[model samples]
Target: MGMEAYQAQFADHLPGGGPAWLSDLRQAAATRFSSQGLPDRKVEEWRYTNLKPVQAQLFALDAVSAGAAPPALLESSYRLVFSNGVLQSGANDLPTGVRLAGMAETLSESPGSLAAHMGQINAGQDLPLPALNQALSRDGYILSIDPGVMVERPMEVLFLSDAGTCYPRNLVLAGAGSEATVVEHYLGRGDGEYFVNAVTEIHAALGAKLRRYKIQQDAFGASHVATLAGQLGDDAHFENFDLNLGGQLVRSEIHMALAGQGAEAALNGVYLLRGKQHCDNAIQMDHVVGATNSHQDYRGILDDKAHAVFQGKITVRPDAQGIEGHQLNKTLLLSDDAEIDSKPELEILADDVKCSHGATAGELDETGLFYLRSRGIPEAEARQLLMTAFIAETVAHIGHDDVRAVMERLVGEWMAQ
Candidate 1:
């Protein structure tokens, strides 16, 4: 029920006979997690979201069998399926310049390959969830792209969970002048209680372009917590979008650093919460050099007794001149009991930087709803139309057409509910 229970399971959960560096990493992470324990409201970054529910229950680290099948694969995309934190299937025919392998297998055969990328982005962070993930994670994927190569098809990784708890760690490396798109789809199979703690690290080299999308459709009884940490090199572009439609309690965190000049990063997300569901989105963008650009746009729709929180911060260093940073968060409360807390912050140490942030939480526009109803549309239909239009603005930023269409369809389904 507390940190002790998790610590008790550490030895049993750890992978045996791996490289010494990996073992040392896991041991260090275990020590850190033990010292910090599960974060509470006292922690500044986790002030709005509570982890008591997750800490109250002791989840099994492994499942006896896999659950139901995952969602249908996206058309013409390379797919990798993980059920209950174990690799179930993989694509046989990958692109020429792309290499995708499971973390467990990679560690066994070529453990030294991960020494450079793993934990490099999130080093020195006092985050307990990520530390716990690093200590216990057993199965995930490692994707690498060669320089100057363009991946023709999108890569999809589907994480399917049924019961118990699983820690998944993922890494992505994009070489110089390469371009690719990746999708992370998390789905729960049945109405069972479970927990998923995931961490993903990304590194984009100079002149590389990477687009990442995440769709969280966890079960109503599940709790999900995930962090995505990325670093961009000179002239590199990184784009990320998240769609949260399920999970009883969910926390999605994104941390990005523009470490090189001319780098760009964009973070966009949409969350639809109802029936007492709670979702939190925490984002941080750092401009470490000159001529870097970063943007954050997030929108949420809450009904019933649902609650949502958005915390976004942009920091421009003293030497980071000519940096452009902007953040905007908007929430539509469909019911009087629904609530939202939004905090947008800007820390500009450079006088030559242009940084701004804004947040708004209110009900849908009455005038737009009235106009839609005046056009002979029913009240429910008019409300749906208005809400759809509100979220469409953020969804338009998705670069891939198929992913965008799937997200739109999922939004429509959630609205219909």
Candidate 2:
């Protein structure tokens, strides 16, 4: 069914307590989606990536009964599982002193808190996929760390897609002087065609420290689109790493605002693509205050006919002096048909700032390959070794030891295939 039919058919079934503001927000988002439709290549931001694969498919609400149990997960003190866009509380465990609840439950219990930040990141935004998520989201989670509290363990959010279409919206808040780690994991289970559109909003108050990781491994037959937006407070620290290695067509957009003096932010990602896969990573860093530091680093490995795109932009406001901003993107093309488009941008209006951006795309070094083969290494093994070393630099930026190890292992598994 088209978006209009789907909206008219599933409006009543949407999760809510019939609040007027919530209803009005959903209606407005739905109308926006209908009027704008899906983004096309004509759009400047989306010019390099074609989204026809998502637009051609007819999406319907996923059947709850169709969901299978979640797969085995890594060890974490707390984990939340969402299957086919519905949170499965029966399978979750929470850490003490940390507030965790589904979006609907949070709205019912603490509507005022959610109301203040629910749609702040994506509300009335022009992004198509995020707009759709706002209009028809069925389930997600909210996590908050109490002020002056330190969480000793990492939190995990697992999203499993069995079939059909699912939209999940998540929010995370870190109180002042708090510190914590969060991991968002996505996995797909069936050969059935499906779509996953996800959105996440995060906020870090003054003196807070937040570390976030996004790991996506969807089914080869599915389509995935996601957006992550966050704002940092004075003297706060925020770091995020994205690892994408799945789905037929995938796009990940990340936006960060450095709104606080002395705040430091780091955004990094690594993606591996093969066969007919396509992935795009678009990142924007906004320097709204002086004496802030921001960095963006991304790497990609493309094989066969796979394609990838990286667009990184850093903007400094006129009043934001004494800023340090750097952006870099590097890619390795392993096949003749492999292709990548790399764009690095810097828009600086500040007079006293240090900012630079660059991008590089190329294939394996013939000289290095020859040297490895001369040392008695097989050609395939040699290629894998070089690729691993190439990506290790970016992976080292991940803060948590366990998470970094898991991501390294995942890259090895992909190389074996």
Which candidate number has the best TM-score?
A: 1
**Candidate 1 lowest-lDDT run of ten:** 56-65
Question: Could you tell me every candidate's TM-score relative to the true structure?
Answer: 0.97, 0.94
RMSD of each: 1.5, 2.3
Query: TM-score of the candidate numbered 2?
Result: 0.94
**Per-residue lDDT for 1-417 in model 1, tens only?**
356766776766766678898888888888778777888999888998899888854347856456656555478888888888888888679878898778988888887999988887853245888888888888898889999989988899988988888888999999999999999899987877799888989999999999999999999999999999999999999999999998999999998999999999999999999998999999989998999999899999999999999999898989889999999899999999998999887888998888888888889999988988899999999999989998898999998898899899999999998
lDDT for each candidate structure: 0.88, 0.84
Tens-place lDDT per residue, model 2, 241-279, is 999999988999988888899888999999999999999
TM-score of 1: 0.97
Task: Show where candidate 1 strays beyond 4 Å.
Answer: 1-6, 56-59, 71-73, 123-125
The pairs that clash in candidate 1 are none
Q: Which has the greatest lDDT?
A: 1
After aligning candidate 1 to the native by TM-score, how far in Å is the CA of 333 from where it should be?
A: 0.3
Model 2 spans > 4 angstroms off: 1-18, 56-59, 65-73, 90-93, 122-124
